[model samples]
Target: MATNDKQPVDPVVRARRQRIRRKRARQSVVFGVLIAAMALAALGAVAIYNGAVSMPFARGFSSTVIPADDPIVPACLVEGKEKPIGYKKVRVRVYNASERRGLAATTAKSLEERGFTILATGNVKTGVQNAKIAYGAKGVGRAYTLAAQIPGVVLQYDARTNAQIDLTVGQGFDGLIPEDEVKLETGVPMNNLPGCQPLAELTPAPAPASAAPTEDATASS
Candidate 1:
């Protein structure tokens, strides 16, 4: 016979244990709901924002926008366009191939006055019949820009060093166009590209052997 020394369980103790168990279960359920809600919110945020534009925090309203990796849109009022020829980057030399004295100096002076970096001015041994714009290596477009400076000029493709373009004044040379008439003839987006004009060969070819570009000017100076 075992001695039944253990008294009946206290009703108060049992009730307290039950209450604590119920409270613990409610707390677990609440914590699980909170975690699920947070996860869903994170997924929703990712799905909503894609690649329409960069992060909105990166810029501000009604303020000057910063440049980005890709070229800026024209509407952005930013100049991110790629130019085939940058005028300031190329070296230009003006040589007087014309019989007229001081034509080289005058041409060089004119160019210098109009934002051109003049190297040196001198005279050619044999004055050409038509003014020639000679370029070496990747100076064809620069040649075109040089050709544009003066009217009825020839383009000569020659291999030279240091000088990107040579302005050889010729017999037909009168003077640099009036400051108002210094428009460069360009059919393409950039002047460095080859158009229809055949490069300078001889005087009086009538038309260039290359593509014939409509004689349109690009600048006033």
Candidate 2:
């Protein structure tokens, strides 16, 4: 008789309770998935930081296309070191080894006005007395050309294989000497200096030319 007194539960209330339970279950599932994704991301970042993994986007390109140690093609040395090369043909980089600021830039400007190609300008670590012209074995003539412009410039032969010249100005450096002071020969080949390397030795051997096509081969083509 006491159990019969309890009323039956409403169908509408039961359906509403079921819907709330389903919504809570879906929310919990979504939260768990988010936490798992965040944990994986954190692990990936740690791996990259420890150098255990490399990212493709982190690598960068090299500054230069050719390696510095690779051999370079020699310039035209038809006259060798004895004869002077034209100022326009000389490629130079001006470096200031003195305490004076902007010396390299000013010197480079002056050389540019004299028809010399200024490649770069910077400061050097070692100091010099007057100035030094550094050139490679194949750049002796080019160095001579630049030496004519700078007074009391010493020529230094290095291990480089190209024709580019480096002009390092020192504490005692002044502007280029007077044009009349430069001693150079315009035409006529001069005798090579004692113990000087010949052009044949300095220049690399030319590659053999390919055979020309025959008349019959051309006609067929």
Candidate 3:
């Protein structure tokens, strides 16, 4: 009796086997990606934890400080006119109710909180027992000046007498105010005061653009 030779597997059966192998391979790659993602997330959490615990002033620096007599006052208030040294168009003054300490850092924090970007900081000068600080703010081509006086004593008066802030916002001769309005105690209040608006908005006419030569124009001409 002749034995029947076994035929090769059918094409459909071979194709099915190949498909199953590919499916398993894809599953493995997906699983590996998920594991990597979880590990990265854990590492990020650890970094955040370390930063929060080790950071200085985690709660943020204080904006309020006791106001003292300003050192720049004598120079600025000369002849009863509060003339800024490097006068710009717009300026804003922020008052701290606490005596000055870490003033540069504090002023930076305060202005940033109020959505102002600091362009420059002036030098700090010594007073009887306090210090005077100056900084400038710029946004949308408009400039603002900020000046603060830090008192020597930290005492709380019956009313907030020592703490004062002056915000001046304007440009050129148009924004200039009278001598009395620029003073610490007598200057216009920031909230109810007029003319703190940005210069770009108030100015009606756009600056004229430079003329461009036409391509057809002769080189000699």
Candidate 4:
């Protein structure tokens, strides 16, 4: 009986109400899609930050490689008269080959005082009667430069590929020759040793300061 007073709903109003419902459903679907998209974006950012994913463009870049030592023959090897290579240019690593304690360090200090570039100080198993100046073909002049300092020093050539000279202290090593007694001719070109090898035929040592860890002969811990 109460329902008899109510009018029938308008068709246009019904259609509008249906359209509103459809719009709300579409909005809900769009919001859910947006949330999913945001979550995926966040995951992608995390992956990039963690280095799990890399940008395609970034693969084009790379780190620079250090160039090898230049193939240069010592001037003394090529020319009969060569300008003296200063102690500063000559690199030396001292090794104690005898029972003398701290001999390498003491000898390095002495050489350093005379403006020599002492790379390191350590010990070697090989024994010598007097100090032995070991050198590679690239360090012939450098070896001679060190030989000028130590009295009764002997030269021993090796297959090293660097210009670094090794000064091995021996049992008979007293000290560096007196500064006054060390006579280097002034304004005179240094003469090459007799029967010197062709520097062009030998491999060059690593550049200064780029010596490998395996090449190092550091003091025993």
Q: Estimate each model's TM-score.
A: 0.45, 0.49, 0.25, 0.54
lDDT (CA) per prediction: 0.55, 0.67, 0.34, 0.71
lDDT tens digits, residues 36-74, model 3?
Answer: 999987887787787743444455476644344422311
Residue pair clashes in candidate 2: none
Task: Tell me the lDDT of candidate 4.
Answer: 0.71
When summed lDDT is taken over every stretch of 10 residues in candidate 2, the lowest stretch is 212-221
Poorest stretch of ten by lDDT in candidate 3? 153-162
Decide which is better by TM-score, 3 or 4. Answer: 4
Off by over 4 Å in 4: 1-76, 194-221
Candidate 1 lowest-lDDT run of ten: 69-78
Q: Which candidate has the highest lDDT of all?
A: 4
Order the candidate numbers by TM-score, best to worst: 4, 2, 1, 3
- Candidate 3 vs. true structure, TM-score: 0.25
User: Where does candidate 2 stray beyond 4 Å?
Assistant: 1-82, 188-221
The CA-based lDDT of model 2 is what?
0.67
Model 1 TM-score (2 dp): 0.45
Model 2 C-alpha lDDT per residue in residues 87-163, reported as the tens digit of each score: 78899877777677777778888889878998877776654667877677667678767876776666655666677
Model 4: residue 186 alpha-carbon error in angstroms? 4.8
- Scored against the true structure, residue 8 in model 2 reaches a CA lDDT of 79
